[model samples]
Target: MTVNLLYSITGLLIFFMGICGLMFHRSLVRQTLALNIAGAGIFLFLVAQAYKSDTVPPDPVPHGLVLTGIVIGASATALMLFLIGVHQSVSKSSNDEGERGS
Candidate 1:
């Protein structure tokens, strides 16, 4: 009923969905996307938990941590996508070379 409880439940659900996607999908890109989803859920949960008191201001530490996590997650996702592209290109080139040789 409370906002924090709702957010916590929603975050957990999203995180679980991501885990399921990661487990079921075969493609690296899909898995990467799932990982990002999970990270977002975690960040949301942290943000929700940061505000316990209605009168006092929300804690800045968790917000700062979430911001840092988002940056790192974005960087890691970009790196993963780039690597996946490289892998696909290399695989394609090798297949093409094989076909030509044969």
Candidate 2:
């Protein structure tokens, strides 16, 4: 089998793992991490496909796209974390206020 094929297969497995993690975990952070892992798998798969056996180096187009994807994913993850933190803080404060009023 070709190296690209192997990489694609591995990427698929990792992607599935991330999906399972998201489905099974109750915590928001865990779900975000799972999404990140899935994103990584997709990047790896794309890079693998762009790799040419005849060429010493891989295509630049896929690399650029993967890099952009990584940056976007990073921003998205930060926003998700921030949102989760805000939600948790608000929920805690509200519960505390309710208890005090009771």
Candidate 3:
């Protein structure tokens, strides 16, 4: 009934969905998206918990943490994509070389 409860429930759902996606999907892109979804859910839960009441100010610590988390998540995703690109390029080149040799 409460806003906090609703946020918590939503966050849990998103987090679980992400986990399921990660477990079931074979594609690298999908797995990366799942990780981002899980991170967002964690941020949502933290922010929701930091809320005291309508009149009281929310805690700043959670906000700071969430920002840090976002940065880290972005960096990780970028790195993963870069690695995937490098791997694909290497594989392609190797395949091409093999074809030329034969």
Candidate 4:
């Protein structure tokens, strides 16, 4: 098989793994990580598809879009993590105070 085909298979496997992770994980952090893993798979797939061994490289449009997507995903994930942290901290604090009063 060709290198490109091999890459495609690997990319597909990564994507499936991510999907399974997202489905099975219950905690917010785990789910988020799973999503990020899936995102990485997509990025890698795009990169693989755009690779041309003996040429100037595949089209620039997909690369540009992938770059933009990566930036957006990173920012969104940062915000998500912050929100999750805040939520967990607040919840734990409330639970602790309730226990102290009991």
Pairs of colliding residues, candidate 2? none
**Candidate 2, residues 1-102: lDDT per residue as tens digits?**
998999988988888888999999999999999999999888888889888887577788998999999999999999999999999999999999999999
TM-score of 3: 0.95
Best lDDT goes to which candidate? 1
Q: All candidates' lDDT scores?
A: 0.94, 0.92, 0.93, 0.85
Worst 10 residues of 1 by lDDT: 44-53
lDDT for each residue of candidate 3 in 68-93, tens digit (9 for 90 to 100): 99999999999999998998999999
Question: Local error of candidate 4 at 36, Å?
Answer: 0.7
Worst 10 residues of 2 by lDDT: 50-59
lDDT of 4 by residue, 53-91 (tens): 775758777688789979988998999999999999999
Ranking by TM-score: 3, 1, 2, 4
RMSD of 3: 0.9
List where candidate 2 sits over 4 angstroms from the true fold: 54-56
- 56: Cα error in model 1, Å: 1.1
What digit string (tens of lDDT, one per residue) describes model 1 on residues 1-102? 899989988989999989999999999999999999999899989999888878989989999999999999999999999999999999999999999999
Listed per model in order, the count of residue pairs whose N, CA or C atoms clash below 3 Å is 0, 0, 0, 0
My TM-score estimates for the predictions, one after another, are 0.94, 0.92, 0.95, 0.86
